[model samples]
Target: MEIKGLRKIEPYVAGSQPTGKNIIKLNTNENAYGPSLAVHQTLASFDAHQLRKYSTLDQAVLRQALSEQLGVPANQVIIGNGSDDILSMAFLAFFNSAEEVLFPDLTYGFYKVWADLYHIPFREVPLSSSFEIDSQDYLVENGGIVLTNPNAPTGIYKPLDQIEEIVKA
Candidate 1:
């Protein structure tokens, strides 16, 4: 049951559980609201039998609907289980075995953990004086890079222009 030289694994820690039924669920950082009425209606209208099939893979029709709602082209959209999934996909698509990934020292620790799990090299770039992401700090090419917006706990959002500059670079 034991694999030799594999004991360096760290445990995953989720936010604390709630103690009361009616207690406010502020722990997970989920928006303090429920799904839209239309979304609820859509769920109620969902056909459970769809699950019996392949479920249309990524469900292009729903993706198109999201594109219309967000005013973005379908080609520009990417589907993922969550941001973590998106991060993993980016690492896979943008990085190679010989390349490295760059991420913040104070952001989601999961990024580094993923890098290690995948055996991808990575560098931890430092945060700014005000805990901001300075894109200019990244100097490597042909490597994956990650940025967690509105970085958790601190919840401070960086400017869109900064992200634009990073993408442009």
Candidate 2:
């Protein structure tokens, strides 16, 4: 049986994993320094007995802490396993085939994949000459916009006022 939205979907090419000891693996999509000391401490203190059951669905404690730190309501937070899971959920929840989603031509790369998977059409607006995301590029009519703040690869960021302009447009 043919899957819907399967046609024209190019397989995602992941970064290369070169195997070797003493080799500096630079292609990783993760932080150069692995988990922090805080993460290690949390893992060490975790209750092994809790492994027998599912984690709490609400993550109340984590959400409360994050809410306090971010000064936002706990209800505004929605934690997930990782960014991929969160992005997948956002794509499925917010976008549809009716109109195209807008994103940068050079970005996290997963945006296109997520759009395709959800059967949502997407348009890629090219960055400026210096590989900077001009907020004006996203002002066109569209269903929704997705972008990486402090854009990847180039690491250029748009100022808050420019971002506000994009949002208002």
Q: Per-prediction count of colliding residue pairs?
A: 0, 0
lDDT of 2: 0.85
List model 1 lDDT by residue over 66-113, tens digit each. Answer: 899999997778888887898778777777867667888887777776
Q: In candidate 2, which residue pairs get closer than 3 Å at backbone N, Cα or C atoms, i.e. clash?
A: none
Tens digits of per-residue lDDT for model 2, 2-78: 78856766667876787776666665654667899999999999988988998789999999999999999999999
Give the TM-score comparing model 2 with the true structure, all chains together: 0.83
- Name model 2 segments beyond 4 Å from true: 1-8, 23-42
Deviation in Å, model 1, residue 51 alpha carbon: 4.0
List TM-scores for all candidates, in order: 0.73, 0.83
**Regions of candidate 1 where Cα sits further than 4 Å from its true position:** 1-11, 44-50, 97-99, 139-142
Cα deviation of 155 in candidate 2 (Å)? 0.4
**Candidate lDDT (C-alpha), each:** 0.75, 0.85
Model 1: residue 6 alpha-carbon error in angstroms = 7.3
